[model samples]
Target: MRIKTVQAWWVQIPIEESRQHVSDFGRLRTFDAAILRIETEDGVVGWGEGKNAAGSAGQYAALVHLLNHEFGPRLIGRDASQITAIWEDLYNGSRASAAAARGHALPELARRGLTVAAISAIDIALWDIRGKALDQPVWALLGGRSAPRLPAYASGGWADSAGIGAQLQSYVEAGGFRAVKMRVGSMDDRPQVSAQRVRAARKALGPDVELMVDAHGTYTVAEAKRFAALVEDCDLAWFEEPVTADDHRGLAEFRAATMIPIATGESECSRFDFASLISHRAADILQPDPAFCGGITEAMRIAALASSFNLRLAPHLWAGAPCFFAGLHVLAAAPSGYIVEFSLGANPMIHSLSRVPVTVQDGMIAVPDAPGLGLDMDTDVIARYARQ
Candidate 1:
């Protein structure tokens, strides 16, 4: 189907103070995303999302502007089904033709960051359109789902040493979650304090519940090592984003020193960045965010790397509906896929944004079989919270 219209909105849903959790991203007052809509000439519409910052705390006006003023215009009258070609076209810019002919990327200088995030939104929308046009789910189009339901881990814990345990337990009791994650690193002032919080959570959840700690890429290599050493007996499921994505060498070093599986990449963009992680032997798990890592196409490419490299795939899903659904589809189809990250924080992007709210039943979420993303967008939510 030919693309007819491309539009985006900066949906900024305010998080109530009581429900909000503070992290390295600061107070996280608002949940932000570039929510994209792509409609075909035949009236088929698809949804997408893009992120430029961590934990739903970035300014999406720039991302929305790019979609409306720049990327959106490029999609006009183009074939919505040729996803890969479109991705390459947007990524390579003027050199797309040459890049295609040469069988590798000769990308634009602005190939990463906001540029890729913009492309991510478009690619996700195209996939949604492709699935709907074919009258199949996105997972089915990719290949087929690995299982009917996948395990989900609660992905929010910002409470301090005393309160963190109760907070995580509340998530476990609320969703029947067997696994949970908590924040560590910079927010706690020191590695030792962060370690104490993790230990306290471990004691509360007991040995049966799976525990994970995320630094949100806010730690130095030395600090991550210290945190890992302190919690060595806690038996962590994984250590997520212990160090910044910029320090692959440091990540690899910490990953080597610790027995915990190193999960990072939500801050990263595209398959090339993932390839570097693999090449450096940095991570045992790859955490691609469908919104930021070049959408479903590039995310699947990263999944391929995970499968090939014998790494685990647990996509970062603390994002909007399109991105969240895209990750579910990827996890369903990808062989390397493991657990899903279900946000425990107050996120309108997932539950409030959809008519049929996605729920995790007994620590697992069912893979959707409906055409495109099964969860229908709540137009009212879009209209109400949309930042002009």
Candidate 2:
């Protein structure tokens, strides 16, 4: 079972509705979903999706060319199961370029957000290939603790006090959900004002909701602290990305000052990037996105590092067709850290992309027992929605 060919494609599915948060608007997400078709001499082929949500179609396209033209040529006869060596080859050999890109090819830079996204897609595809070769789920291959299911949280994007409140209520009433997170930091930076909104949400959702707030890294240390202190009584699950990703020290300061746990890492790239955050004890929770943080391989490594510090691992997911399953595989194997982020809005790409529509029952996602991430793509849907 050697990798015969690695192919990548750019897919564009029109998001029926614009995804609006505090400071950003996702009207048209142009992402590159890498379909790595690893073929065996015996004629068995497996598919994988490496999708970048930061719109890295172009960068991912470049990576796809490199993989198929350069790396694929070298790996044609090599065992597809050698994922670690291949990942190391891509990492160390690609390090100079990766450093030059400075996550520009990844997602740390605004202009090259798509490039990082592309890397994410390809990386995910590689994992799928590795899993298929071993006849195991990506999580088990990655040495994740086995669990039949994992807890989840409702990630409401850009809902106001009223709109968000209703969304939370619906999730709780539906069962399967133990926690919920709301997007915050849309308005002014007054801590008290944000507190009032949280208070209102709490009143509407009641006390046991395990409320959490995401500032989208739109606040400063002072403002984050202000909001954190006020919401201490709100029974927050965690405070996510209160300050910008650049402000690791600011996050450290904010965490030190607040009683609420500080959660971040979605914006971070590789394990090296997260190592600094862990060493500094900057955040109490880690939210690594498989799409943004390389892929399952890197995410598993990040989760392990977080476990050493007794930190929580909750992946940050927006709405990508393949990313949900990709994320689920990693979370499934993860020990103790099981909650995954979910979108409240209707996303056709996620529902229609899979061979099986991903279902969430009682706020917990069931792990698919099938091979290679347990997902199959609908090419017709891809053809209809594929970016022209």
Query: How does each model score on lDDT?
Result: 0.91, 0.68
User: Candidate 2, overall lDDT?
Assistant: 0.68
Number of clashing residue pairs in every model?
A: 0, 16
lDDT of 2 by residue, 227-270 (tens): 87787888887888899988888788888887888889878877
Q: What is the TM-score of each candidate against the true structure?
A: 0.98, 0.84
Per-candidate RMSD vs. true structure?
0.9, 4.8
lDDT of 1 by residue, 287-386 (tens): 9999999999999999999999899999999998889999999999999999999999988778888888689889999998889976598989999999
